[model samples]
Target: MKFTSGPITRPLKMGAYLKVSYNEKRSQVISWEKVNKNDVPTKALAKLQ
Candidate 1:
């Protein structure tokens, strides 16, 4: 990692997903799922800080 401290064992994957549903007042997380990394959109990925 460019700015991470210590040794990195494994690479990070963009597979974690949270399904959200909105209501009249506020939004809530419905469920959490692990989606395929390839299924994720490139624009959604963030650059390392």
Candidate 2:
């Protein structure tokens, strides 16, 4: 994991952020706020199992 700034070709707020995660065979882009939501976690956990 790493944190980097700049090289953004657009404008956004401070809390507006994105996350990219890659496993051995898959990759995904996730929004910070959306993924951290209380409702989202419950729904996601149910689907995972």
Among these predictions, the greatest TM-score belongs to 1
Q: Tens-digit lDDT track for model 1 on 1-49?
A: 2221135544445544433244645554343345654665666545411
In order, the Cα lDDT scores of the candidates are 0.43, 0.43
Query: For residues 1-49, could you state the per-residue lDDT of candidate 2 as single tens digits?
Result: 3443435544444443343353645553332332333444566557655
Model 1 Cα shift for residue 26 (angstroms): 2.6
Off by over 4 Å in 1: 1-24, 47-49
The lowest-lDDT stretch of 10 consecutive residues in candidate 1 is 1-10
**TM-score of each candidate structure, all chains considered together:** 0.36, 0.21
Off by over 4 Å in 2: 1-40
